[model samples]
Target: MEFRILGPVQVYDECTGVLIVPSGAKQRALLGALVVKAGQVVPAERLVDELWGQCPPTNAANALQAHVARLRRLLPCGEPGSGRPHHEWLVTRPLGYALRLGDADTDAGRFRRLAAHGRELARDDPGAAAGVLRQALALWQGPALQGSGQGTICAAEAALLEENRLVALETLYDASLLAGHCHEVTGELEELVVAHPLRERFYELLMTALHRCGRQAEALGTYDRARRRLAHDLGIEPGPALRSRMESVLRRQDPAGAAEGAARAVAGPATGTGPVDEARTADDAVAGAVSVRMLGEELARLRGHVDRLTREHRELAGRLDRLTSSPVAGPRDLAS
Candidate 1:
C-alpha cells in the first residue's frame, strides 16, 4: 500500500491498483495527522483537539471514534493470506490510535530519501543529482496535505513539507548550474528570483548564470534589482555571497589596460643602459604595485566565498537537525 501525504491524504493499494480516499474533510484531516505521525500512538484527546479544534462536540471522544471506525472501513486490507485485518493498519493502543504502516510507502518519505540521496550526489555528480532531485520534486502533485483543512498538526506539517520542497528546488538549480547548464537554467533562475525575491541565493545563482552567458550588463542589473529588493523588503544589503558575485562580474569587465599592466608587471623591467631604462623601471614598479593590489582583491573575494559557504553550510546543518528531531510533542505529553 502507498499512503501519500505529499499532496493529499490518499492511500493506494499496490496489489489491487485501487485508490482509497477518505469520504470527508475531517476524515482526510484525521488521516493526514495520523500519516504524519505514523508509528506513534496519538492520544484520543489530542486527536479531538486536532479534528475539531476549540469547537469540539460535547461527545468529542465518541465522535472521534466514529470517524476512526469509518476511516478504517475505507482503508485497504492486508495481504490476501496474511490473515491481517484491514483495521490493523489503524491500531488502537491503550493511549490512543496509531497508523501502523509496516511495509507501506509514503510519498513524503520517498521525497526526503531521494532528496538526501540527491544532495549526497551533488558533491560528486551534479548531473546525476539534478536527475534524482527532479524525480523527487515530481512526486509532489500539489500543495501538501491538500484538503486536510487547517488543523494545527496538519498545518504545521504541511508548512514543513512545503519548505522541504523549496529547498529541493534550490538544490536542483544549484546542481543544474554546477553541471554547466547555466545558459539553460538562466530563464528558470530568473523566474525563481521573481517568485522568491527574498531568497538571495537565487539572485546570486541568476547573476552567475547571466555573467557566464556573457550577459554582463544584465548580471549587474540583476545585482541592482536584488540590492533594491533586499533594502526595500528587509532594510538590509545583499549578503556576502551575492555581493561577491557582483564584484566578480565587475572584475570580469575590467579594461584591457589592467590585464596589460599585470602582464608587464610579471615580465619585469627591460634590460637597458639609458634614461629610458630608468623610466621603464619606475613604470614596472607602479605596474607591480597594481598587480599586488589586484592579487589582494582576488584573495579577499575568495575569502568572502569561503565565509559565505561556511555560513550556508552551518545554516543547512541546523535546518537538518531541526528536521530530524521530533517535530511535535507526543500525544500523551500534549494532553498533560
Candidate 2:
C-alpha cells in the first residue's frame, strides 16, 4: 500500500492494482491534511476547520465522521475476495485520527529521503548525485494536491511540498553542471527562471550555466534581470548567496565555484546528523572549495588563451583582406 500526496491525495493498492482516491472535494481536503502530517493524530476539530473553514456547520463533527467512514471504505484492502478491512491503515486515536505508514510508504517521504541521499553524494560524485536527484524529482506528478480545494492547512502543505520539489530540481541542475552538462541543462534552467522569477537560486543556476557555456555576457545580463525583478517585486536585494554569485560572474571567476557552493547550500549542517558526520561534512566543504579555486584558475587561463587566438585570427583576416583587395597584385607581380 502506498499513500501519495505529492500530486493528489491517493492510495495505490499493490494487491489490487487500483487507485483509491476520495471523490468529493472536502473529503480530498481532509485526506490531504491528514496525510501531510501522517502518523500524527489530526484532531476532529482541526479536520472540521479544514473542511468548512470558519463557517463549519453545527454538525461539522458528525459530518467529518461521515467523511472518515466513507474514506475508510474507499481504501483498498487485501486480495479481492478475502473480506479484509482497509481500516488498518487508519487508526482512531484519543486525540483524533492517524494514518499509519511505513517509512517509505508515502511518495513525499521517499522524495525527501532520495533528495537527502543525493545531496550527501553530491560533493564526492556529481554524476551519481544527478542520477539520484533525478529519481527524487520523478516522484512529483504535478503540483501537490492540485485538485483539492482551498483550506489553509491544505494550501500551506502544498506550498511546502512544491518548494521542496523546486529545491531538489535546482540541486539536480547543480549536479549536471558539475558533471559537465551545462549546455544540456540551460534550456530547463531558463524555463525554471521564467516560471519562478522570484526564486534567486534558479537565477543563480541559470547564470552559472550560461557562464560555463562561454556566454558570460548573457550570464551577467541574467544577474541584472534578477536584481531588477527582486527589487521591483520584493523591494529587496538578492540574498547573500545570489549576490555572491553575481560578483563571481562579474569577476569571470570559475563557474565551477557555483557548483561547490550549491553542494554546501543543500547539504549544510543538517541537525541530528552528529559530530563525527559534521566533521566529515566540513572536510568535504573544504575539499570542494579547493576544487573550485583550482578549476577557476584553469578556466581563467583557458579563457585568456581563447581570447588571444581570437584576436590573432581577426588580425590575420584583416591582413588577408587588404592583400586580396590590393589590385590583383598577383598578375602584375608575376609579370614583373
Candidate 3:
C-alpha cells in the first residue's frame, strides 16, 4: 500500500488500483497532517488548533470524532479480530493521531527524509549532495494533490517541497561546475533562467559557462542582462558577487583558469586570442553564471556566421555578373 499526501491524499493497494479518498475536507486534512508528521504522534491539541484555529464550533470534538471514524474506515487493515471491536490501523488516544508506514510507505514521509539527507550531503559533499537531491526531487509527481485542492497542511508542505526542489537544482548545477562539467551545465542554466527570468543565479551560471568557453564579450553581456533585470524588477543594482565577476571579465582573463576549472575564469578560445590563450568565467554570485555566458556565446557565434555568409554571397554575385558580361565559356583559351 502507498500513501501519497504531497499532492493529494491517496491510498493505493497493489490488489486495487486507486483507493477511495476519505470523504470530508476535515477528514482529509486530519489524514494529511498525520502523514506529514508520520511515525510521530501529533498531540491532539495541535490537531485541534490546526483544524479549528480559534474558531472551532461548540461540538468540534464531536465533529473530529466523526472525521476520525471515516478515516479509520479508509485505512488498510491487516487481519480483523472476530470477538470484540477492532481498531488496528488508526488508534485514538488522549494525545493525538499517529500513522505508521512500517511495511507500507508514505510519499510525504519519504520526501521529508530525502530532503533532509540532501541538505546533509550538501554541507558535507556537494557533489554527492546533488545526486541525493536529484533522487529526492524526482519523487514529486505533480503539484500537491495534483491540484485536487488542499487545506493548510498540504499547501504548506507542498510549498516547502517546491522550495527544496529549487535548492536541489541550484546545488546540482553548482556541483556539476565543480566537477568540471561546465559544458553540460550551461544548457540547464539557460532553461532555468528562462523559466525564472528574475532569478539572478541562473544568469550567474550562464556567465561562468560563457567565460569557460572563451567568450569574453558574451559573458560580459550576460552580466549586463542580469544587471538590467535586477534594476528593472527589484530597483537595485547587481549584488556584490555579480559585480566582482563583471570586473574580472573586464580585466585580462587567464586561459589556464579555463583548463584548471577555475571558478571565476574568463578564458580564451582554442584559436588563441591572447598572450595567455586565456578567458575568465564568472563565479561569485549565485554560482550559476556560466549558463548565461554560454547563451551569449551561442548568439554571437550565430551572428558571426550569418555575417560571413552574407559577405560571401555578395562577393560571389559580383564575380558571376562580371563573368556574364566579359568571358564567354572560356578560361583564357583553356590556358594551353
Top-lDDT candidate index: 1
Q: What lDDT, from 0 to 1, does candidate 3 have?
A: 0.67
Ranking by lDDT: 1, 2, 3
Q: Which stretches of candidate 3 lie over 4 Å from their true place?
A: 12-24, 43-58, 80-87, 112-130, 144-155, 214-218, 249-336
Residue-level lDDT of model 1, residues 217-324, one tens digit each, is 688789879877886889667888987887777655333334454565567646544444544555455445544664576467568868989999999887666655
Per-residue lDDT tens digits of candidate 3, residues 1-336?
778865556776654465757665677678777777777777776676657767877887777777777887787564455332333556776777787766678776677688678777765587777677677767777665543334465567778867766776777777666656788777778889878877777777788777776776778788878877776788666777776777666554534444464432344344544423233332222123544564476467558868989999999888777777865648853342
Output the better candidate (1/3) by lDDT.
1
**Reference-based TM-score of each model:** 0.73, 0.71, 0.60
- Runs off by more than 4 Å, candidate 2: 79-87, 102-104, 253-336
Worst lDDT 10-window in candidate 1? 253-262
Between candidates 1 and 2, the one scoring higher on lDDT is 1
lDDT tens digits by residue: candidate 2, 14-105: 76677887898987987888788788988888888888987998888788888888887786544456565434667788778877775328
Off by over 4 Å in 1: 79-87, 253-336
Top candidate when judged by TM-score against the true structure: 1
What are the clash counts of all predictions, listed in order?
Answer: 0, 0, 31
The model with the greater TM-score, 1 or 2, is 1
